[model samples]
Target: MKDTIKEKVASAVRSVYGIDASDAIEKASFEPPRKKEFGDVATNAAFILAKVLRRPPLEIARQIAEQLSGEKEFTRIEVAGKGFVNFFLSPRFYEELLKKIVETDFYVSDIGKKKKVLIEYVSANPTGPLHVGHGRGAVVGDVLSRVMALTGYKVDKEFYINDAGRQIKLLGLSIYYRIQELAGRNLTLPDDAYMGEYIVEIAKELMLKYPEIVDMEEEKAIELAAEFGKKVLLEEIKKTLERLKVEFDNWFSEKSLYNDGKVEKVLEFLKEKGLIYEKDGALWLKTSQFGDDKDRVVKRSTGEYTYFASDIAYHYDKILRGYDKGIDIWGADHHGYIPRVKAAIEALGESGDWLEVILIQLVKLFKHGEEVKMSKRAGNFVTLDWLMDEVGVDAVRFFFLTKRHDTPLDFDIDLALSEKSENPVYYVQYAHARISSILDKAKEEGIEPSTEHLNLLREEEFELILKCYGLKSTLESVAKKREPHLLPYYLIELASAFHKYYNKNRVVDTDSPELSSARLYLVSGVRKTIRSGLNILNVNAPGRM
Candidate 1:
């Protein structure tokens, strides 16, 4: 629809000025009317062309409106608000579009052009199950992947395992000491050792499997402990994500970067480019030259690779895997880490544009007006599993996405479980359910959905139709902005308009069967659109919620 309007406007511009103004034509875009009196679609083409035409924008707008007045696509075209051209679509236009909804199986565009995207998210340390913090990043990455895929990108969901380095060694030591304590050896845990009860659980499980681990050398025992802990926690992470209905296309192991010599390979490349420097026995990347506040250690003095080094290798591996773009969903705390990673990408001779990171703020859980404290099992924050069992997977994904990624979200445990209209997710699902009920009832009454009398649809009915039509644009915006929160908000507004419409009008009125069929046609479209939007967010939109 936008393309049709833009093409006509481009033709009008040529006819009026006798010159090509493709750039201005491209700049011309439409906005929904600020007032119903302003008409269906409003554009500012004349405002863009005013200087080029050497005329007042308002005069140019009037001339353009005059030229377009004969267009059958628009029933009314008028100039208003400093050269804004308001266009009211012909009744035929709305009738055809609303009919297209239920008459078609699905409607989506190939806007992404099949660009391959690697979306790496929730790469939490395998120290414990994912908490609410990791859950936020998971949803962001997961939904972004869905959005990109819908926009026609070839997307691969991934979780990068931080299974190598000091953290892993500490994980092993934490479990080993816990095992020692359980075996009657009161070994003191190191200050940096993990302190979660899950660590003890892992230790107990390991004891049963490796009863002779105590007899092994200390260094060898810790290695075995670390490997065991990493495997267990990683499996748990996978299960938790699976339960949350968030699955990754790949689980790229950070240990592989070291094992496959990716870390050393990138390190050597940087060294030869003079991008890496040795400082006090540590190999440092001159990240300061690439917008970091200071140089960063890729490898510490003790010969252990830094987490940043592993991240570089992981991304380099992504590039080597033939992805056109790479996106990493990270905690907001890692905002400062973006530049160093970008620097590494550039140092590896890839454009920084190839890698983009979305930093998401943590989620805070609240219950009954007070902070829901403690993870009972994990010993600290709320785990994603706990939240899922408490509320539901649908509510968890929906509510987690109700706010922008950069904003801290306070998940209301009480609100999510509430079936009342105030629950946003439930409210939207109810809209779908209501439509399904109407369609089902219509089927029983022998009044099938059809576009038989679409002309009977009034202006208020177009409110829902237009909003449903906005879905494609909404999704395109989401993919372009790299924000998935826009989807829920759009859904909420669409659902609200639909529910309000249902309150005032009947979708399956037996008294007016033709009108009923048309309205049912619109309702069916609305239901499918809502379901599709929910599906993209990985939220459920049950036909009977």
Candidate 2:
């Protein structure tokens, strides 16, 4: 639709000025005007052409508007401001769009162009339960995968388990020492050890299974403890994510890179390519040569590989798997980690653009205008499971995306639990339910939705149609910008439009059968569009509050 408008403006420019404005036309943009009174859509082609035509922008705009005045799809084309042409779409145009939306699945788009994409997110270490921070990334990645797949991209979701590092060793030690304490050994846990109560629980479970673990060698017992702790925590992580309705297609383990010898192999490959060097008794990668701030050590002086080494191997594995793109969703604190990873990719003869990282900031939960800081369950941090139990999976998933992922979000617990319109998720869901009731009441009166009398749709009905038509564009924007917040905002706006329309219009009036039928069709489109938007976000569209 936007392309059609751009072509019409280009043709108008050619016909009126007797000159091809192809180059300037490329700079033109058709977007919604700032104010509703301005029009439905506006173009800045005249501003782009003023430089080429050596005329005032206002003069060019007036000429273009006059040329496009007779367009069938536009009710009026008026020159606004100094050089903007605002187009008021005809009612018939919206009527046709609404009819199509009612009769078809019209929200899908080809914006992704069928590219194979791998989205890895919420790769939290398997040492403990997932916190709210992980929950935020989980929702972002999950929704993005859905949006990308709907937009013609073949996407696979992944969770990278960071189970092969100092953290895992510490987790094992934490549990091993707890078991020793259970066996009546006077052992004091180190300050760096995992102190959560869940650690003791894991130790208790392991103790029941391995009664002789206390007598085993320290190194061997720690390994056994680590394996048990990892398995138990990983299963809990999966269950928690499932509780929130977030599922991944793959659970890639960082340990697998070492088990498969890929980590050592990558280092050797880089060494052969002259990208690795020895310095200060450590093996370092020449990351600075590929846009990093400085060289990075892949292997420490203690003969242990850093996490960066495994990450490089993992991403190289992703490239070897033939994905067109790999998106990593990391915590916002890992902002500096991006350049180094991209550097690793470039050092390996791949374009830095092959890898994209989305940084998810922290989520601060609030209740009754006060920050709720502690969670008794996770010891120091709030767990995703506890939050879901407090509110619901729908609120957790929906609220996580209420703001831009890169920005910190202050989630209001009271608002989430509220049943009023102040709650965004509730408001949108209520719109779906309200429309369902309207349609049900219409059906009871034998006034079925019909597109035959769509011409009878008035200004408010056309306005609702235009809002419903925005679903496709919203999904496209979410896929392109990687911003899932736009979908929720779009849903809120659509619901608000519907609510306002419902408050003013009577859809099941017996005196006006034709108008009632036309309005019912519009109402049905709103319901379908709302349900579709909510479904993409993995939120429910309830038929009743």
Candidate 3:
């Protein structure tokens, strides 16, 4: 619809001023008016073309309006203050929108062709259960993938496991010491050993599984415990993600890179390209040359590669999978690491534009107006599963994605759990349920109102229908900006409009059959919008509270 408006205005501007298409279309921008009375849609075409045409903006706007006098979609086009083109959409257009919503299962728009894009997110180390910090990234990445999919992108959601890093080693050792301590054996634990209580439970399971190897050599014990620990942690991660309703298309392992010689192959490729140099018994990647703060060590003096080297190899593997673009959703702490990763990709002869790193900031949790801090070392951190138990997956996902990914979020548990008016999620859901109730009542009364009768809608009914019509535009904006948070905000506004309309009018008034039919069409449109928004966020919009 917006595209139609832009095209019609472009043609009008070109014909009215006897200008070329390029000159007239270059300055066209379609925006919604702040005040509805001004018009439904407004444009700044005249303001942009005023200088080129050597005419006053108002004069140009008037000329464009005169040319667009009888357009079908628009009721009237007027030159407003300072040459703005204010367009009032015909009521029939919105009525048609309502009819379209009920007639189709999906909204129609030119969502670009499907491009293979890999999204790597929540690649949290498998050293322990996922905490709240990991939850934020999981939610963001999942919703981002969904939104991109809605925009007609072939999205592959993945979890890159850091199963071969030092963290996993520490986890193994943590389990080892815990097992020895439970057996009444004296052992000193490393400072970096995981202190969570789940470590002890894992140790107990390991001890039970490997009774014969309880007194084995340290190396054998570490190896056995690390294997067991990794299995348990992976299971926990799977469970947490399942509870959160986040499903990944793949779970890529860092260890796989080593097992397949991909890491060595990547290093060799860098060396062949003169991007790696041996200096002072260490292999270094000249990342500074590609805009890094300084050169980074790929291989240390001990002849083992750093974590960054493994990461580079893993990313290279993603590119080799034939994806048109790659996206890594990391936490804010890894923000500084983006530059070097991009540099490595550039050095590997790949366009940096193909690699996008979305950094989600921290999420601060609050309960009853008090801050809740979760620390891994303290072993008191709130796991993702705990959050799901506190608030259902719907609320958790919605709250996590209620802001821009780059901005820090404050998740108030009490607010989310509130069934009262303070909870926006509840409010939105209530609106959906209310519409469902109205539809049920209509069916119960045996009133089979056809959507084609929406043409009899009034100004208020059309206003609600217009809101539904803007869904495609809202979704396009969210996808283009990579901001899934906008969906929740828009849903809230939509619910408010519906609730206001419902409170002011009755939908099932038998005397006014025309109004009743129009209201039913509006109800169907609202329900469709709510369902679409919730699906994008991976939430369930229940028909009942």
Candidate 4:
């Protein structure tokens, strides 16, 4: 749409002053005016070209306006506020948009050329179940992927499993000792051992799968248990995500990268670039040269590669897969990791811009204004599964995305579970269901209004139609900014506008057929918009809630 406006303005400038398109068009900027009275759209072309044309900005704007006099889409074009070209679009423009909305299957406009994008999110360690903090990242990444896909981007949602790290080793040892304790054997669990009942359950599963390993030495038993525990835990994680309405295209494993020699290849590439050097008996990457805080170790003195090294290999694999861009959704606690990862990408001679990181802040759970404590020992952390079972998947997802990704989220359980209409998710869904009910009534009454009769829509109908037209721009801005919170806010505002219109007017009044038909068209458009918004958030838009 911006491109369309730019071309039209450029053509008008070229036709008015006989200036070259390149020079005249290069100076133009299309911006939405701040005030509706100014216009729906505005440009600063006259201000930019005033000096080159040796004329006042208003005079240049006047000449361009004269050249664009017969443009039907724009109702009026005028120079305002020291050379701004303000254009008020004709009501027919909005009518056409409404017709398209009713005729189309989706609400969002097609703005992208369907570029493939891989979004890896909530790649938490599988040693334990996901906490509420991980849930925030999960919902943000999921909703963003949905929004991008809705806007015509081919999105590949992914989860990176860190099953090959020291955490997994600790998990194995924890289960081995817990099994010993359960068997009346004296053994002390290590400090780093996982302290959850799930460990005991995993140990039981391991004993059933491989009874021969139960009698082996502790070290060997731990090694076997770690491998088995990782698989079981990962399965549970997948189940939890599925319950939350989240799924991934791929589950990339860190251990697979090691088995395939991808880590070695990434290190060799850095070595070839002179970015890796051995210092103090440890292999270090010169990340400081690439704007990192300090040089980081790729391999520690203990001969074990650091997690950062594995990350570099993982990202290298992503680039090798031929994706134009890669995105990682992580918790805010890992904010310090961004610069080093970007430095690694740069050191590898790839553009750092291709790697994007979205940091989701912590989620603080509250019940009646008091903090809800999480106990790892009792397995009482607010897991995503528990949240879904309590308030349902739709409410959980909608609440998670109600705030900016970077802002701290407070999940009030009492408020979310309330039966009142104050809950925003319920409110939005209710509005949609109400509109659906009205449409159903219309359909049953044999009063099907065709698109031709939609031309009789009134002022409130046009206002709602204009709001629908802004969805394209709103979605574009939200996706480009990696912000999904805007969608929920827009949904609430749109619902409020609809409810206000609903309270003031009667949709099925038998006296005036024109008004009734117009109201029906407006209601149909609102229903589509509501469903589209809910779909992007992974929430349900029910016919009856």
Best by TM-score: 1
Off by over 4 Å in 2: 1-27, 34-39, 44-72, 75-88
Greater-lDDT candidate between 1 and 2: 2
Per-residue lDDT tens digits for candidate 4, residues 1-545, read 44456667778877877776546655577767778888877888888888777889989888877777678767898888678788877766667667776777534544456777899999988888877788888889898888788787888999999989789888888888877876778987777677767888887777777776667898999898888888888988888888888889999999998999989889999999999999888999999999899999999988889999999999988888877788899888889999999999989888888899999998888878998766543365767766776788888999998899999988888889886667889889999999999888887876555565666776677778767656666787778899989988889888888999999988887677666777788788888888888887878999986
Q: List the residue pairs that clash in candidate 2.
A: none
RMSD of each: 2.6, 3.3, 3.1, 2.9
Q: For model 4, what is the C-alpha lDDT against the true structure? A: 0.82
TM-score computed on alpha carbons, candidate 3: 0.91
Model 3 agreement with the true structure over 115-196: per-residue lDDT tens digits: 8999899988888889887988998888878778877888899998889967887888889899899989989988778887
Model 2: lDDT of residue 225: 98
Candidate 3, superposed: residue stretches over 4 Å from native: 7-27, 34-38, 45-68, 79-84, 105-108, 374-378
Name the candidate that leads on lDDT. Answer: 2
Question: Where does candidate 4 have its weakest 10-residue lDDT segment?
Answer: 104-113
Task: Return the lDDT, model 1, position 20.
Answer: 80
TM-score for each of the candidates:
0.93, 0.91, 0.91, 0.92
Q: lDDT scores for all predictions?
A: 0.86, 0.92, 0.83, 0.82
List runs of model 4 lying over 4 Å from the truth.
Answer: 1-36, 45-60, 105-116, 375-380, 444-446
